[model samples]
Target: MALAKPSGLYPCTRSLPQAKTRSFPSLLQPKLHPSPNPSLKPFDATPGLSLVSSSAPVLHLRPRRGFRAPPRASSDPSPLEESPQKDATSEYGLLRRATLVGTATVASKILGLLREIVLAAVIGVGPVATAFNHAAVLPRFSSSFLGGVNGPIHITVATTLSKLSKESRRQLTRKMLNIMFLIGGAFSALTYIYADEIISLTAPGLQVLAQGNLIREMAMNQLKLMTPCILVSGSMAVGFGCLTSEGENTYLALSPSITSIAVIASCAVYILMKGSSSSSLNSPLLGVFISSGASVGSLMQWIIQVMIHKNSERETKFISWMDFFNDKDVHKLFALMLPATLSSGLVQITSLTDLYFSSFIPGAAAGLSYAHLLTMAPLGIFSSTLILPLLPTFSRHTKPSSLASLKENLQKAIVLCMVIILPITCTSCVLAGPVISLLFQRFKFDSSASSFVSSLLLCYSIGSPLWIVRELCAVVFYSLGDGNCPLLINLIAIFMNGILDWLSLSVFGLGAQGLALSTSCVSALSVLALLLLLSNKLGGIINIRDMRGPFLLLLICCAISGFTAMFSYRMLQFFLSTISILRLFGLTELLSILLAGILGMSAFYLPLVFAKFAGVFLVDSLWTTLLNR
Candidate 1:
């Protein structure tokens, strides 16, 4: 699941007043300003107020006083005033917010990792594991694409709500919640009814295996059990968006941990009942428990979000359900939501394609899923902590006069993302085997499984940076009210991804690693295409010529990090080969991993700090702030 980025509706520095001091629910408060000139044409009621018409009458909504817009360039086109101390303070604030979110993300990711580890140990990458992984594709895809914090539904609702008055927000949210619940229910029913057909379509290879009938039956059963999540997940996303719009980010950030914990508890119960021995691992029973746990967890997530919203000062009194259909904002929101939903769906299609291909190779489906979890662990942390907080700033700067600021912010965001992502990519590629071994090489996950997963991880790690870039760039388009661009790009990339997958898997017989490679290649292409189009749209906001220097510097630092990590791991293995103490306690692998990672990061970051490389100031400032805090 992805971290929710702030909708471009509010400035990051602007937050809602305390609930205790408010006369009315904050949901009824309006965040937009009416045009200063009454004679000026009213803007269209499209989400984000993206459509302006001189002849139309603007909505007569009252704007909140004391809410200042972000500063813009002067009429003469002079740059906004900036003092070093003020800039430092602003940077410090951004870093501080990121750290808060990052801390939560780390906790959630650890729990999620534990969930995956438990699943791997209990299930292994066997036929049953592959079946479950395949069965999970649609439910996971729906949850991540439709209901994940950063998914289309959450972003659409948050962005739309940000534009409406508090009263309007409440009415629209209530109606949206109802509508989503109905939609989710209908979809869930369809999925449950067609579970067998869906599983066969997704994992056709399962029908031809030695125990094909058993795997198919297991997968179909799991899919039916998980189908409820299709609905609950969407509802959860809406609740998440509501909380985010109300400025209750802490709860939203930590909510996924609840789902992880639920899964862990469920897994523990099953293990206790069946015992931990490999022979005692009952695939069908375990699959049923895990799938049911996922559905229940999704429901829990939605319930938690609803409870938080109800208790928030932002909550409003219950209004007539008819108010939902009468609201223009609700219609506008769905209009904007449609394209984003399709775009997200297209992204999921790519995942489906990968699974479809991987199913033909024994254990490839499960192996791919395992590798993905490992790859996503760090990606999730950095993307959530760093890129998420910057989204609203990007949104707030989309006006023509603010394009310069947007350009600067975009460049900085890209550089910062690269600084964090590049080294992880490099280090993971070099240390994929050890990392996989250290985290997952116990119990049923044996050396063969480790080797298979590590190969896939290496491919995923290489393309991880591209994935980050693609996501950030897509957000830029979303903020700019050009959702079609990403949708179109995804459509094209999907075709390319399929072709690559076929060539890699069928022609070359590369199996799961081929699927990973195809995904990475397609992601790289998508990033390039997005950059080119975004550059044209912004009248060349990004200059490849200028970015070359920073890109080169990042590459050099990443290379150093990779080499150091690889060298350190080898040295530890060779020197510690004689050390029996670590072996006796089974701490050798763990110690080796920690030492290698620390040394690698030290080698990667120290040079950037000392040499003051491009974008190093972000890390330096964050560190300084951490010390003072």
Candidate 2:
């Protein structure tokens, strides 16, 4: 499961790797994993000036005799010549990406939460925290880099060209495709050339990997192998987004999942090679890196997409790529992507800066990253997953009335994110210690790391909701073909983040955890700025205030759940200490904490269950009602 499908409606869909293109046979090859559920449930906030439901009521009123509930209204645009019809009941395409993607993202976030707890408990907050985070930095940066590289041209070309002449459109697409590929390839080569120098800058000691003198030479090794992904992903974005807008999301959406699969495989392979020797395990330096993963995954993704694009060209005879460069279209593409890169690149640069500063500040090198991982566990769910799948459908609509409809969808997505994440973030902040204990206390992982990481996690959790909000705001603007505004906000926020990082980490002596807190603050500010900027441009294209009450309700519920979780944790601890026969009581107690916390959220949302409110507050239709009203 992944937080919102990062772009696809499911993990299978948002894999991002699907943008990869190879020859025909490989492209046509059957999938290796089970297909994902395209249908999902969504939670929502209320409509303005309307009564809302906490849950559907059991009523005497029933569907017409022999009649089923009317199929759900679709949120995606009515099909155009190039677009596909979304599910009538869907909140997105025919299948409703919001529901499927949101829920899976929620589930994935939950699992990621568990995964992080496990890592924290197992690794502790010291060397391992630094190591895992260090290992993660490149991959995280790469995704952001790719997002930046592709974000501009994607919306610019996709939104604009769909309005262009057919023959002119085809010709332009082929040229853009070729040029983008060549640029991405060049970027990959540059990364290969300077990976070590770059890594050394981020991690001073790891340059030894190039010398083959160290076991896991992290110094410069990590950057060398991983940076290539930014290039591959850049090339793939234009192709995938183009096809997806035309209603071909099956593979393109699922490609990112391949990265996860590859990472897992690489870890498993490394584990086997190393064995379980305590002596060898003592070294945090030896961790799984994904350069090879990128190399292989990129090929897989590229092969499939290349095949699809070429095959489609053969049948349709619609595209031409000769004279790709020096054309007006190339200029337009560059005009679109250039600002996007700088804007998107700002985030990665900040992250890289975080690494730089964190390394210098005592144990911070590891601590800040540890905390970030915990927070990201949820972000991957609520924010990344939803935004990725939503962008295309959203870009397809620019009409004032359509923005109104989509605002409701955004409202629904926001409420759903808060419902799950609010409770989790608050409870995790309160129970950071114990949860970290239960999850990561095995093998080479230790308690110190857990404690430190937990402190940082709590701080980061404060801004959990804002992360998703930022994504929604950016997507809304990007869909409107206004990348420049969001880009500006991202840069400004980066500067603010830098100042805060210095104050929190250096001035306050709050350490890595402080750095995380600073980042969260900046993130919230970015959300505010993005929203205001869009509102100015949109002439009220989007309205987030109507749902403020529901957001408040969700916040209140989260508070109650968190307080209850703390109480449950203490009581469970006491009971377990007293019962010898129930030696496994600790496990049972953890379950109670989780269950109670979940129920607490349910109890808070209970008001939305009634029929009147349900129409506006339910995830999909209810949300639609609320927004429409």
Candidate 3:
């Protein structure tokens, strides 16, 4: 008896000749087509149905005349090829990787916060702390713009390497590393030699202070100590990109904690030697110790990253030194790096501008630093985890054929960022005072410091979402191979930031808080301009009308969350006032902040779920992913 063909199975050709009958299990059938050449061996098609093509130009389905079908020839392509389902699975894998990276980032950020807390307690917002903070401007900028996970150097290396062949990438990595090392070494030498001049230029107002000479001297020494960071910073950034591209994201995501630990250890040693004595807390010696710790921490960061890159499975062969200047890919990296580096430098210039204006006001720089730490804790976690992973995906989708996918990804990224960050920004703004009090209002960090820092924190909070959007938008520009657009945007932003800084400080009498506000305003305006330009570039990929609904919803949710958090905090504070025991050691403030944040987030999330908002889907997906792991 003839066996029936499996349902939904059909031959690609209509004409065929009769052949021998075959009987086999239906499920094991291999779907195949007749070979054009009759001399070719017969191949299985739908298991029981084998296709045998003859010289007569007709194909025949027949029994295999054996119990098992012949093995697929080594020369034949596999039956399983790239399909939509496979592509989806690959995308899912990328998402899983991103989720893992994000989780590690959160852990790292928590450790970083602890490190900041330790520094605040040990150093306080005194002269030494202020001087260290000011002197750290250059090093901090270098790390953030160069060695940072999403910095210019990192982005350039990651983007360029993704497009090159395996052998080409190996050649390029060695060349880039060689070039960066030389550049970094020269920069470090120059920085070390001119530390005094750089400090004088950056913080000229320091010379007019009561302890101007002491502060200036300490700052110069601190700058000298941190000069080596210029060398390490470039290497670290390139290593981060290399490791991440090779799928070793855990190391890059968690490496900052190594630096944090190093700083914490250094502070711990200092505290041990001092024996809880506040008298010598802000001494010049302590400043030197902290500065040295910071430099050591940076060196440690570079060492760990380099080691990880070397040990990774994707390690490349070391190329000759001449290749550094001759490789086309290395030159492309330089082309991309130049504009990206300039863009990042402009951002640092904003920070420098703030420092310059802040120098006239005592303790303002330190307050700004403290406030910035709090703002960055959440931003860093979200950006490093979410934005960094999406960058490679974005670069992959930059081709004209994939523009639609790129547009969708960008829109989703923006919406997701708004959903997750908006509530935090609102809560921070509302509970700024209590949060700062709980975190830093202890030991030498007094109530005055808390007040000033809280004000700056609140102002900085207003710009948190803006900062995230700015970063995401920049990633889009970078992915599209147009780093100059972001450069231009930042240049304008720096100009605006400077003008606003002057007006807020010198004219409006806002002090440090005004500086923070100016940054927020500039970031907000810059992101809007960037979005407009990006939309035009992509043929109106962003529809303002479509965005308005989600934007409005998120705004409402944030406002509600902020109000609820404020009310909850006030009620808790009132209740704590009635209980004397709860007021000790900032217990009341701590409890209030915890309770307020919990209630606020609960309120913020519950409404979104009830309303079935678009953002809720992403939240659900992320939560599900976490649970599955």
Q: Predict model 3's lDDT versus the native.
A: 0.75
Stretches off by above 4 angstroms in model 3 are 1-94, 313-321, 576-588
Please, what are the lDDT tens digits per residue for candidate 1 over residues 1-629? 01112123221222323222111111112223333344433223332111111122213222355544446556733222222222212445467767777788888889899988988888889866887898988889777668887788877776666556787677677777777887889999999999989988988888777877888899999999888779877777777677655544566567778878887788899888988876667558888888888888877877777776677544434555577668778778777788888998998899899988877778888999999888888877777775556555555567887666566566556767777777778878888998888888888899999999999999988889877778778777777777898899999988998999999977998878889998888889999999989888877755565456546656788889989999998998777767889778877777777788878877888766654454555666666666676
User: Across residues 345-449, which tens digit of lDDT does each residue of candidate 2 receive?
Assistant: 786767766676676554565566556767766666545445555555565556665554455455445555555566567777877777666666666666665
Write down the TM-score for model 3. Answer: 0.85
Ranking by lDDT: 3, 1, 2
Candidate 3 lDDT, 1-629, residue by residue in tens: 11122112112333244433221212112324434455433333332312111111222344345535448699965544322222212324435666888889988888888988888887778888878988898888787667778888888788777677777776677667666777888988998898899888988888888877788899999988888778778877877777655556787778788778878887888878876677778678888878888888888887766666567543435567676667677778888889998998998898899999888888888899989889988988778767777766777778886776677667657666777788888889998988888788788888988898999999998888878888888888887888999999989988899999999977899988999999889889998899889888876655565446556667788878988999999998889877788766648877888899988877887776665565455655667777788
Ranking by TM-score: 3, 1, 2
Candidate 1 vs 2: which has more lDDT: 1
Whole-model Cα lDDT of every candidate shown, in order = 0.73, 0.55, 0.75
Please list the residue runs of candidate 1 whose C-alpha ends up more than 4 Å from where it truly belongs after superposition. Answer: 1-89, 313-325, 627-629
Predicted model with the maximum TM-score: 3
TM-score of each: 0.84, 0.73, 0.85
Of 2 and 3, which scores higher on lDDT? 3
Per model, how many backbone clashes are there? Answer: 5, 66, 6
- Residue pairs in steric clash, candidate 3? 22-63, 29-46, 29-47, 30-46, 30-47, 31-46
